[model samples]
Target: MKKTIIVLLTQLVLGLACADTIQLETGSFVTITLPSGWSANLNTSRSNEKVYWINLISPEKNENAGKIALDRLKHGWAATEEKFIEHMSASIERLSASLKEQPVSLNELKTDNAIILYQVLVWEKIVSMITGAGLAEYKGVGVIHIRYNSGHTAMITVPIKTLDNSNELNEILNIAQNMQISMPLSENKEEESAQSSIQITQNEHGTVIGNPDISRVSLLLPSKNYKATPGALAIGRGDPGYFIGRDMVANVIMSGWFSPIYKFKYKTARDLWKKDTPKQAKNLEYLKIKEWDVMVHELEIPIKTQNTLQVTLRANLLEDGTWIDLRLSSMGIASQRADMRKALIDYINTLQVNVAEARGFHLKYTKQGVIINAPAETPGSLFIKTKSLLLQKRKTHIKTEFFLFQDSGEDIKVIAWLRPASDYHYANVKTLWDETRATLSGEGFTVIGDTDCQKTRNWDVMLYDLKTGDKRTRNVNMRASCVSGGIWVDVHFTTVDQRDSSFLRSKLLAYLKNFKVSDSHVE
Candidate 1:
């Protein structure tokens, strides 16, 4: 299906960024220069043409100050600074109407360099009422607008908390100066329709491999070939998949491979693709794709039928140790086997990857915590909670950051608590756990076997997988660690339903594989 057109635009969003800067595209009017460790996400799309919301992200681990959105508006170029500022004030007012809090103060700027007209707004914040006193902890909200030619305007904003100052907004604006507008990507619907063409011609010839010259990843098709069924990229939803073809009649197994893994370099392409394969596969041989060395595998049996199919896959290693694997199958029909094999062989021989040089992945800023290369996650719904709380007292402080993501109809949670190691007088993790175990549960928590306590990235660490609570309460799967005198962090997931224990436990373990605390996030 033409399922991937709009979706493909953002697939390469975080890949291959270079030279101390990351690029961000709104898929609308602007693409901006994002400094390293900084990320901006599209917040809301408005029917007002080019008007939209882009969130400014904080690099801090658990800065849940709520969303700070920059309003972008496109209009006719302002004849004077006065006109620009007036336009900006009106835009802010229209946006502010939907907000719980209203703008209380607005100011215009007179600058030495007058290429851009500017305005900044300070807003009254809504307070959370407690017993009798309101939690007036919010400092206020600050917004700065920059109006430029081409009828373009952008703003940087934040809900300033008492602990954070106005300088936070200033620092953000200074960073904004480095941003350059990115040209809009073409939104031709034809690109979407073209993806479905791979499946159209079926019953007589082999699959029509996409053209090598015009395609993103190059390969050739037979002169008279059938089109395969529709498939999405296995790694992401609605992304283009490798065309699957069998006997020109009906193909059972269809698949593709995607990698952001400059991380798992030495692993064979079979090693990567096998993870998503429906049936167990066995490594078969190693061969050469032109000058590149490739590994091969044969799927044991992908689909069950008397009419059997033989599927063999080959992958080539790129210069940087990355891999691109091609999977082709031969049907049980004797005549079709040779035709499919010959077509696939010719296609494989001509395969060429024309992607950007691989770079390590980027970090995504979720509302509660930052994700280290996690894919599109719709967090904080009824099924999840992206709640983050920062607590402080006379001498103790703790930041409890929660990221709850559900997969396979089960809730998976990561609750991270960050505290200064000095709270425990810089005690070894074993001692701290021995002491804190009593505080978390009346029954006491169990320490998983051979708890790992190793220093990594300047954090002296300790880890214990703990479990406690009875059938009446949720189960806790937790890890506790200390970074010498700097901080102690605990990450864990609590199962919501008692019946989900085993399934949740296994999923939690798999989920933990992607969980990481960025060293920059450590206080």
Candidate 2:
């Protein structure tokens, strides 16, 4: 079977010198050489089993009835050689029937590296689905399936008029035969030289944006045809690590935001402003690439003076407490959309994120001048600000909260409250703890006894044994505090059962051990 496939493909094979590689948004890659005057566009925004499709347009546009396409198989549909041929044949037969053409023959050829299946359909006048207009000639469909040894398979389909047009068919088949497939390479594996790797720290693999002093990092971008630089945006930029991308002529501008993942409260980019701009905000795709979940959205943001700018926002969500947000904006009209999309995809393909260095657990609140470190795998949770008159002379209060998830139901909540000495005057750290305890007691919270108090060089600590007096769900809660001259850090731990509470308490202490508060306050 393999011998027949090899002989058939060897007979129709053509050679090309140069090749272009395309990285599919679905975490696969394809490399194929194109014939001169032929253009290729990869559609990475498809919401289907086919991860993406590469559209190949021939130079003889007037003569060719349809463009050749290579679609990457996904969802375990073409995982094996048997499944690859099974799905490809099924698709070809279904498509032929829909076009009202009889399936002439389905031939299988096997090469040393891949399994090939080609089918020729009966010629028929193809009607345009959009305009319902008849085509100039009767179109014959050519469906080819190429499954490489690397477990990557792409189904190639093109339009053919007759068997006599072997030149075009051979060219299309040659592209399929000579195509190369591989898995996406990681930044650590791909970049090894000192020139390619940015080494501010041993773990840092990519480039740093905004202020490197704060330990902000993101993917390393290409600097040949594109220019990258740190910049301030209208949206208050320094902390989020804002950077700009400019083309050779500066016709297209790209703004990127890279920061700790905890800063983004929303699940997806569309959720950021979908409620406000329902009509203008459109989610293009959500792609899962290795350890990252990328959410892409297209927005028509209105600028009061500039009318509107076409914006493409890509939110790259990394599991290790970091995210990369990129916005590609252009003032070009709708007609130039195709060109813009091609440029966007091509640029995105070049990005290689340094996952090892980018996954950081340290978070700094520049405004409050506070920095806190969490468990390596855990990211800080969202917080809702609230005001309280706990202190007698309370004029200003700021709180930072983090809910670390240990397991499915186990959670450790940590809240840090910053108050300058100018606003509240407490005789000692014990007085601050007394005020906080009184506030909780007034709010219908019962304080369990056996509480321990310790005086450390950094702060006066008060640890609560257990606080539980509610008709709500059954839960075990332990709250503690480390109060300094002007800084107060509250550590709250909760679990479903008392047995689990002990295990969670150790995790909470580990976080508190690493936690450090600087002498600087919000004063």
Best by lDDT: 2
In model 2, the runs with Cα more than 4 Å from the true position are: 1-28, 36-52, 59-78, 95-101, 127-138, 184-523
Q: Which residue runs does candidate 1 get wrong by more than 4 Å?
A: 1-254, 259-286, 291-311, 316-326, 335-338, 357-523
lDDT of 2 at 91: 58
- Clash statistics: count for each candidate: 4, 2
Global Cα lDDT for candidate 2: 0.44
Q: Write the per-residue lDDT of candidate 2 for residues 26-78, one digit (tens) a residue.
A: 12234566666665655532211123445666777634433433333221122
Scored by lDDT, model 1 comes in at 0.38
